[model samples]
Structure formats: C-alpha cells, structure tokens
Target: MDIEIFPYRVLGSDTTEALLNDLESLEDVKRTVIHGPRFPKGEATLPPKYRERRVININGEDVVLQVKTARIFLEITMESTIDEIEEICKEHIPYGFDINQDRSNYIRKQQTVTDRIKYGDKELPDELVGMTDQYSTFDDHVKIIKKDD
Candidate 1:
C-alpha cells in the first residue's frame, strides 16, 4: 500500500469551485485541502504578490492586473502502481492542466542515483543485468545514414 499526493491548479475561482464540487461528490476523494503560505490547511493558496501584479497599457492609460492563484490538494491511495494513479488523475482532470505527484521517499530514491557510470566506463556484465522486452537495440541506438538514390 502506497500513498500518493496529487496537486492541481485551476486558474479561475469558478473553475476551482466546480472541480472541488465534483470531487466532493465522489467517494474516492477522501480528503481535499487548499494549500497556501498563509493558510497551510487550505486547499489552495493565493498567487504570490509578484505574480498577481502586472502592468498593461490600456487606452493610453496604464492598467494594473491582479491575478489570483489557487490549487487543490488531493491525497490518493495507490493500491496498484504509480502509472495507475496517473491514469486515474488524467481521467478526472481536464486537459491543458498540470498534475504532479508530491515528493516522497519512494520518488526520491528513484530520482537520485547513488552510482552512475561516467563516459568511457566499463559496461556492467550482462549476467547481472535484465533485458527489457519493450526496448529495441535499433531504437536505443539510431544511426544517421545518407540515402544514395
């Protein structure tokens, strides 16, 4: 059993409210919270002042635009695998949006490599390695050749 955190940001408040309402209707979404610097328990936080403030020229007058930032926090339980979790999230969330997994010990381990073979280093023995059927030698190493017509 593994726990995964999914973060989503909806630009407008209307969209955020709609998404939250949809999630609340689902039983699988156990808990949802807004995250922000001011309110740690909230589901989302206001956009930073720097980002919210913008200057634009409108009709010979300078207009300042303030944009609000908000995000939703979903704590999901993964019984199958990370790929399965991502699929579920994609199915629920809309297109052109971003979804990211929260930082965890498992992710850290997978991302950080303790030992890496540098250029010109001796390749590991084949007996100690496992071949993956999904990959092809030709796909792994592609050569650019000119065609002589």
Candidate 2:
C-alpha cells in the first residue's frame, strides 16, 4: 500500500531532513520518494543557504536533497502503518498535512512498456522498480536509500 503526504506549506531543508529521517526509520516502510518542483538555478544574489540541494541524513546515510519537499510518497507494507506515519508527520509538520489514501495509483505496482524498452532482458532491483514514469528518466526522479543495519 502507498500513502501520499501533502504538507500545508512547502518544507524547508531542516524540516525535510528531520521528516525524512524519521520516516526512513519505520520498519514497515518499503520505499519513499519526495516529489516537487525543482529549485531555481540562477539566484546568485540570494544567500548560500537558499540555494538548491541540501544534504539530508536518512537512516544515517547522507543524501543530497535536490528538491524542496512538496509531497512525500511512501510505500508501506501494511495499512496499519499509516497511523505511525501520521504520528511522525504530526510532529514534524505542525502546520498541517493530509494523508491521502483514496488514490490506489500513487505508486506504480508493476513493470510498464518503458521498463521493457529501457532494459530489454535485465532484471531490476526491487527498490528500483516502479519508480519512474514511461516518459521520464529514472535516475532523475528516483533516489534510492539503503536501510540502516
């Protein structure tokens, strides 16, 4: 099952870091991807802190966060796990957030025509599967994280 987390406000680097770290710690969480508009590139006058791509720690691994978090999509094993996710969100996203469960297509469930064309006979890792769309580049949107021991 998958759940879409929509925050009331666009999250800054610090909040994104904290939220991702917390989410990655859950045992039932299979995979997570943050999707949103890309940060603007040519803002030389702005402070260095405002520039895009901040490093965030997820399950003790440091990942370069390229996009400001507009929505977080999580693939969890059980529906009951949603409560735990909501509890974490309530703490991090104090403003508010909606946990949408209505959409069954939030995450892709199987291989598509694109996958067959991209890698003809090659097998993909489970974590890398169902991550990208038919028209888009996989690595451009998919950020894979290793689980902490």
Candidate 3:
C-alpha cells in the first residue's frame, strides 16, 4: 500500500519554530520543511493567495505550519496490514493535531465496492469509511484524541 500522512497543529511566537526545531531532532523523521504566510501578519490570517492552505494559528500568532502538514509518505512493499499503518501513524503524530490523507482515488474505489454489496451484486465484507470534520484556522474548535502510553 502507498500512503501519505499529514500531521499538523497550532501553537503560540517561536513555539511553532521551536516545535519544528524539535521535530528536526527526531531520528525517525527523514525531512522537515517549514512554510508560513509569505509575510507574517498575525494567526490564521494569511495573504489571500495562501488562504486556502491555512490550518490554524501558530503560537498566539496568526500562522499555519505546512511542515506539519506533510509529515511522511510510505510505500509498503511487504504484506503489512492496515493495523500496522495505523500504529505507525499513532507513533509519529503529535498530540492535539489533525491528520489528513489525499486518498480520494482509494475512497472512490471503496464506494464502488460498497454500492455493489448494497445491491446484492457482491458479498458485503469489512468496509472503511473516511470522513473529515470541520476545522478552524484558530485551533480553538478542535480537540485531540489521547492515546494510551
């Protein structure tokens, strides 16, 4: 399976930078790239051209971190199961952050399978549903799911 993982968060001046610095220190991470508003304004408020890419505030400042958005991409050649993928994600993703995957093509194919099963054209098997919840650029509305250590 081929997969891409995007992990992102909003933190308070220098905090985002500090987090990026800390991320760079991690041995598991292969690369880290930082991008913000072309010119800093305040948090979440970006130049119109970059507005669509906005995620949330960066450390009391109105900035979104793109490095956090493009964390890792993997191509699994072995027979690892989906559980293994989920475990890897949980291990690397920071707390109180959001993760998104550009799996539109995968979802579309799953939908076809789902439809076939609904029509009795095929047997119903285990299914996975992908849904995205509304998020704010301020990070005020989102809550993180805690994991057992």
Per-residue alpha-carbon lDDT of model 1 for 1-149, expressed as tens digits? 22433345534433334444454444444344443332233323555542433333322334332223244444445533445445554655555444555444212222112212221234533221221122344223222221123
In order of appearance, the predictions have TM-scores of 0.33, 0.87, 0.27
Question: Could you tell which candidate, 1 or 2, scores higher by lDDT?
Answer: 2
- lDDT (tens digit, per residue) of candidate 2 on 24-91: 89999988988888777764567887765666787777777777899999988799999999999999
* Candidate 3 lDDT by residue in tens digits, 51-147: 3335444223344433323343333333333345455445545464433345532222143543444334544332212111123232332222221
How does residue 15 of candidate 1 score in lDDT?
39
Query: Of the pair 2 and 3, which is ahead by TM-score?
Result: 2
Instruction: Give me the candidate number with maximum TM-score.
Output: 2
How does candidate 2 score on lDDT? 0.83
How accurate locally, in lDDT, is each candidate?
0.37, 0.83, 0.37
Error of 3 at 133 (Å): 32
How high a TM-score does candidate 1 get? 0.33
Between candidates 1 and 3, name the one with more favorable TM-score: 1
